[model samples]
Target: MLWPREAGKFIASKARDVKINMEGVRKVAKVIADAVQEGKMDVKEFKQNEVLPINKGLTTAQLADWMFLINTLNFNFWTPDGVPKFSIEYEGKIHTGYLAMVACVNRAIDEGKKMYDPHYYSKLTLDDIKHIFRSDTPSTMPLFDERVRVMGEVGTKLIEKFDGSFINILKQVSGSAMKLVELVISEFPCFCDVAEYEGQKVAIFKRVQILAADLWMLFHGEGLANFTDIDQLTMFADYRVPQAMAYFGALEYSDSLHQRMVKEELFKSGDREEVEIRGCSIHGTELIVEETKHVMAERGMDVVGINSISVDYFLWDYRLNNAKELEKIPYHRVRCIFY
Candidate 1:
């Protein structure tokens, strides 16, 4: 929640003060410009002195922050401190860029510096890394053949550097939801599926292709939105996405749970169909029916076909307070009942 509005105003003001130190930057730029005017800098000298780090188009506050962070990696990174406000790689690279800038300056101070061509340098991408690593030393096989399929989350920038379709498969959603499951099979890791028997649950999932983690989360959530219908489940079962490291969360079932899913009732009277539970029960709670089918068959349902939706899944919550904390998912009831 926002803290009384005034707190937000104060924070914004404090941030603005540190954003741009205009005066300090003018002093630095003038010193470099003066040296150039005196002919103390050659074309090569000017390149390092003016073009390299100094000409990278960084703002004054950015340059100052970079200087301060490299000197001492401490600054406002988060609000009220829970998770660190900075990414580890980003934070580490901050220091690396700072050191590089300092080294460039030192180089400019000596040997009159050297020339720089913007066209000569570019950021490396994953494909470049693959190519570089493969060609770096003599190798009989390409790097792609030598290593595991995934080399961590290679940056999209790196993928672009190499100019290949390594990431094309993941570019968009598949034509059908089933196609997505197939793609997941071909691409990502699957945590759980019907293929390998997992002790987590005894029953088979209707969907063949799915990310185990996704199914796990969906089942635990017990919501119709996540679980989907049989048609959608068919999509997930077709191919294999690699299994992930862990199940989505802790959820379990008794083999006997599916046992309660027997046909409830079946009745046919003239033009209509009726299904009665016969003597079905839910937690020992009996069904209350006023009229018996023996008297008037049309008025009462003697039996009905059991449905996938009728099979209710339950989670045990011993404590009352946390019981409502959990969500209840209705199984294949509504449409599944008639189908």
Candidate 2:
């Protein structure tokens, strides 16, 4: 199987002949240097407390279920026309897009539904899912039917194969991150994120990899989430991270590609430009991880446990916090479940 780390190295080596800019990478490294010097970038920054639900007191099984459900349905939520995004008011605050989806799931759990249970979700109807994910505002989620279908599919698969628990699958992986990813893609069709480049098969597996990373984060690298090769997982190559990378000068697109993105042109999942953007972003984030470690070493700081997953979280959170500034750059628009 083509794992994410191996795919990053392979696609990046192949992409050097493409029109991606290395000068931009150098500029991003400088930014990383400043962030490290300012003591803003560190693996410890990606704590679960930084997320929502201040005092839910979730168990290990519930947390695993939450991660599995959310990551299975996580995908495109970009609203180019400035419409109100799919949002939910949860815990007295409004969350839009991906966070909103997570909030809704949490809301279901709060309303006395065993939503974390695959057996419960497997029997869910289309309207049940629609109501569960219903937006607070006028804007509804895009690909609503597809999302509903995927929820039922994944839930049923879990019940039939994994004994109605996502934790069972994790236990079967034997503490290997790559094995977990392979298991997810092989068993769950929605998690199969792959592309072909130059007669070579490349595996991005964005959602599956993020699920693994979230497991590691949620468990603090202990229990069922303690994967020995967690560091081997690369960054989740989605649209937002690439935009952040472009803003930080770690990724540059051709003028034609840039214009298309600015105009909100839709690229299919495996289009050449889309693949290049996602692949380059993964490789660029790998570089950022290395550069941040080097800078930490130079500053006489400890760099023992720094990895690509933490770097990805940092970049993703950076993009969210700096949305206004990063919006100045156009993000590639690809409507696919794989992201």
Candidate 1: where is the Cα deviation over 4 Å? 1-167, 170-174, 190-231, 234-339
Which ranges of candidate 2 are over 4 A from the true structure?
A: 16-20, 33-39, 42-54
Compose the digit string of candidate 2's lDDT tens values, residues 210-254: 999888877778988889999888889999888888887778777
lDDT of 2: 0.79
Candidate 1 lDDT tens digits, 149-235: 222222222235323221232233322334444543344222112211111211122122222222222223232213333222311
Candidate 1: global Cα-lDDT? Answer: 0.22
Q: Clashes in model 2: which pairs?
A: none
